[model samples]
Target: MSRFQSKTLCRVGILAAMYVPLALFVGIQFGNVRLSFGSLPVVVGALLYGPLEAALVALVGELLKQLLTYGLTATTVLYLIPPMLRGLVIGAGAVWMWRRGKRLENCRTRCFAVCILAAVCTTIGNTLVNWLDSVLYGYYTFAYVFGDAVYRFGVGMLNAVVVATVAIPLVVLLRRQRVVQEVKRP
Candidate 1:
């Protein structure tokens, strides 16, 4: 592989390693609240490397978390798919927006815009996945799932907003550090 490809693979591996423990700790502690810095890695990996890398990181991270913590419950595994999809969709959207001159390099406005976009995209993706899961499991009617969808959307929106506001800035700060830069480049 070329330098870029090697770097990308390394990044994906590192992200998966870092995110698994962190996400599991947060997931176990926070559960549905999900008030952790897990998404930051996905966003940063996406911005620095690429969406595919970010998606890989997100998926592997969640899988590892589930394996370690819950020993792979069917429900948990099923729920993991949505966040994986959400990370992929949000990362792709963020990268696309950045490449199209969104300029989230240092501008606060650009960063906030990117965050908002991520929030919306992830929220929609997550809601859709939950709705599908509800349908598949036959836990609730379409109307009930629809109501739950609204609740999930609202919570997801809040989570995204909080993550964007807090986690993105922290990721940016970490990115500026020499350690993070070396990791990104290597």
Candidate 2:
């Protein structure tokens, strides 16, 4: 029990710290396109721990990034909604998966599905937030919201894929190392 608790705490701290630096420094940029892998840690945390831990991870990381990068703009807090929601969706899906199967023989497939679903939800949430920010700051227009909607979703999907690709093997390794307790019912 102590081991489990300690492991959880360590993992949570690592994930939260990982999120900020990654968000601040790591990104893909090509012309006007940018891709961020900041959600990877959040997704991994949600899958390993649960919703509350996941949300905390997202909050700490994003809040710190906002303070450091943008210095608390009006939309700073609002922009955090998508990553937190992604964590929530993934964490909730994990619970659902837990309920559905004891062995979870198809864990990989299920993980992929959950990641994709979370990405979709995040894309929608992000779009709404962007639109709200634009309206509040006086850049509102149909084109502003809908024009790049598809592109944003594509980026979300790509991010989800990257997260899952990295997370699955990492989680498997953690379980193998007995860092994370995997309780099975017989």
Runs with alpha carbons beyond 4 Å of true place in candidate 2 = 1-11, 30-33, 101-106, 181-186
Scored against the true structure, residue 40 in model 1 reaches a CA lDDT of 63
Tens digit of per-residue lDDT, candidate 1, span 14-63: 88888876665653233354656677677676655556777788888877
lDDT of 1 at 56: 80
lDDT of each candidate versus the true structure = 0.63, 0.78
Which tens-of-lDDT digit does each residue in 148-170 have in candidate 2? 78887888788788878888888
The best candidate by TM-score is 2
Q: All predictions: root-mean-square deviation over Cα?
A: 4.1, 3.2
Q: Please give the clash total of every predicted structure, in order.
A: 0, 0
Deviation in angstroms for 134 in model 2?
0.9
